[model samples]
Target: MHLKKLTVVALSACFGLSACQKEEAPPAAPPASEAPAPARAESAPQQPVESMPPATATAPGSGSNLIREPVAAQEQPLQAIQTKMGPKESVIHLTSAKVTGQILTVEFVAVPKKRGDGRYEWLNLTLPLKNVSYIDDATAKKVSLLQDDGEAYMASPLNGTGKSIRLDGHSPITATLKFPAPPETSPTISVNFSDIGSFDGVPVSR
Candidate 1:
């Protein structure tokens, strides 16, 4: 009888304690991500993308003319010389190379080729770089390929140079061109080059 009485008292006490305890509310849900494109987020700096490389070509003659420019001993033996807006003549070996006012001068290295009899031929062709195909991907408003031939050719008139070209019969060139600035679309000027002739007194086929 006493055990039964004690059990009832304990149950009554637990019920009383439970009635005094407070209930907790559920936690708030996470904020939705439908965020508006914030203007500068109040305070954050911007960043730009960037990778670049410099480029350069050889001059008219001498060590850089051919022998040492590309690699080891000169490969092509200079042959005939032809010009589009300049002079055309049977040029001998490369005599001398000099850069003046940005124009590279290639003087006859060998005695000018002789006529059937004995006279020499005058040169007339300008180096060819105009036909070089390139694509202008720069921000420059416009881009152009200046041809030594007295004209400029562009892959796209609004803004372009050349995307690709086959200057050398077997050498296909593909590249993107970059210009300095505006209306001067002519991003760069250049010439087609070849060196197939007599080297060190030996007649070599071009």
Candidate 2:
């Protein structure tokens, strides 16, 4: 009977020890997808952005970085005499004068007098002739310049209106005369057209 009682006690002790070990065991591991992620490193501070300089604007139609300059005034032409001449009411009008380098240009207009028939009948034709014989022809041939010091310069036919003198009584004939340049210091000069009077006190300019 004692042997039977000792066997039951030993079996009871073994069952109690197994139940305590089961209660003290660790929990089961979680799945790989449900695991906690690692921490991220902190980002560096942002740097300040640099600004560019503004570009300069230039004038329209001008080169870059260049300023437009003002233009200078132009040289003006010289003046001349405008008047009548001769007893027959012929006229000689000086329009302008210009000196360039060594040449002198003189622009003028000449009007011839109307002819009368023996102091009675007016010889004025019904139609003005395309070409007329007039006193300006003599004037053109003998036109000259008398300087302040009495030095005379003849008209240069090569550079001026040659021997061709056209006269129309209905309207004045415009002509240009070229001459050798006179001394710049000449205070005054006279333009003489023989049988057609003279233009005195013409001031000289360089």
Candidate 3:
């Protein structure tokens, strides 16, 4: 009986020690889904870059962006005068003579012969005519002006009425003539007619 009791005590002590050991052991690890995640790093903001304008190439043998200068012009010289008046001739009377710049103006009166019954006659259609004659045979080109230095100026057809006169004479007719300018220093001149004589020592006016 004593031996059976000792065996029962020893078994009770072993059971108690096994229960304490099981209680002292650590717990099992957690699942991957339940674990905490690692922290993320913070980043700085980026700046925007500025775009520049395109450059232009200059033309060959050309200047810069500044404006260019203007060029100058050329000019001509003026003409001079020498004399004004000329002598008078028969059948032709000089009424006036004047000078203005490079132009010369002369006025005169001419008396022509009466017309004959025939269609053409020497006295009727000939001699010299004026601006108001009925005959178309005479022209102002018949007259000319000469300087004291022997320089002669011819009448210009562009200055006057540019019409030729005919001699169907009833009365004296008046006419005007134009000539090129003479030298500025000429003090005396003469007027000459193709058929009539020349007049001299005529005065010059402004």
Candidate 4:
């Protein structure tokens, strides 16, 4: 019994049983093609696999694809939250998606730092969109592009090499989401938010 919104009600029942197909709202993170790219974070970030105390995520089991919902989503229980983010507790708690139940991912690395001294440095990022378009920027921050029936879907202009971008905060940086065609059997339901790594800020050069 857990389903905050079940990926927008299972993507509006897979685009069909729609009475009007109006329920868009999930786009905020678009603008980064060139201008602001200086947090190179050499290397650091590793001691974080010693787990044995962190639980509180139930609901995600109706059969498969996992996205169940009946009622379950109040959040804030997994060890109280915040797994890493010093100097002010930026926000951490990276990734967790129980192939059959939980789906926890918290991250907001604005400028977090702490490498070489540790081993796990990161500015990670992970979301949805198997077919993308929109890549090039200075970051003023104001993303918007939803479509499950609702509307609003524009951005999609940065690719062709600027797409294979890299963050190297320790590893991780993949992009590509801006579909319109060539997609009919891959996006039945998707929703993600990842970047877990960094609780101590530093490295700023905008």
* Candidate with the greatest lDDT versus the true structure: 2
- Candidate with top TM-score is 2
> What digit string (tens of lDDT, one per residue) describes model 2 on residues 40-145?
2122222211222222222343653243333212234323365746434655676655667876666666555655642322222121111211112222333233
RMSD of candidate 4 to true structure, Å: 42.8
Backbone collision tally, model 1: 34
Question: What residue runs in model 3 are displaced by over 4 Å at the alpha carbon?
Answer: 1-90, 112-169
Q: Indicate whether candidate 2 or candidate 4 has the larger TM-score.
A: 2
| Model 4 alpha-carbon drift over 4 Å, by segment | 1-113, 116-128, 131-191, 194-206
Total clashing pairs in model 4: 24
Whole-model alpha-carbon lDDT for candidate 2: 0.46
RMSD (CA, Å), each prediction: 23.6, 20.3, 27.2, 42.8
Candidate 4 local Cα displacement, residue 3, angstroms: 99
Model 1 alpha-carbon drift over 4 Å, by segment: 1-91, 101-103, 108-192, 195-206
Candidate 1 C-alpha lDDT tens digits along 1-206: 99999999999999877765533212222233334335455334333211111122223345455557675434665443322221233333333323334332333332334468655554322233343222222332222443424344322211233223222111211222222222123332222223332222111111
Model 1 lDDT on a 0 to 1 scale: 0.33
Predicted structure 3, TM vs. truth: 0.33
Q: In candidate 4, what are the lDDT values of residues 1-206, reduced to their tens digit?
A: 34758877787777755534443322223345332444333222222332322321222233322433322342334432224442332344423211112211122222335466854456543222323222112332222233434242322222333332233344322222232221122212222222333222111111
